[model samples]
Target: MFELILGLPLLGGMVVMGSGWGISAVMFALHAVTLLMSLQHRQSFYGSAAGIVTCLLFSVPVWGMFGHWITAALLLVSMVDRYGAGMPGSFRRS
Candidate 1:
């Protein structure tokens, strides 16, 4: 759920990059919030971390689009990997 929310802006910002920097600013804030939430929940944060990087470099034309695509893919993978804490049978900290 959260991953999907985060991903939308990445893809959307690609199309709106010429409009202004507002989209990038919004994405940065969203990623920051996601990072904080992941820390509080002790969940995997690689996707959010990548998103922050993407936001930072998303003004570089070709490379920026690539970053958005890659980050969005990572977020999708993270969404499908909800049980990424550990192996299925292994004990996990609560």
Candidate 2:
């Protein structure tokens, strides 16, 4: 599920680059939904780790403006996965 969620944006980016605007839009939407679902289930450490890595992967500046959205989505997923469970309490206290 996580793989699919991550893959969707990447696939969508590629499709959009290849000129499949309509399918790419649909894939982008699916990617966002799946990423949300993955973050919602990030009880396991692996999920959190994967989320972080995926986010970093999108930060590379080599990706053109068109692909920047993929970066945004990955970062969003990572943030939710990392802190979605309420920041583990240890770092939450003021």
lDDT minimum window of 10 residues, candidate 2: 58-67
Candidate 1 weakest ten by summed lDDT: 1-10
Candidate 1: RMSD over Cα atoms?
5.2
**How many clashes would you count in candidate 1?**
0
Error of 2 at 78 (Å): 11
Clashes of each: 0, 0
Q: Across residues 1-94, which tens digit of lDDT does each residue of candidate 1 receive?
A: 3323334556555545554767677778998998899889887788899889988866665566677777777776775576444668754334
Which residue pairs collide, candidate 1? none
lDDT digits (tens) for residues 30-93 of candidate 2: 5556567755964323333433444344433233222444444555565565556465554432
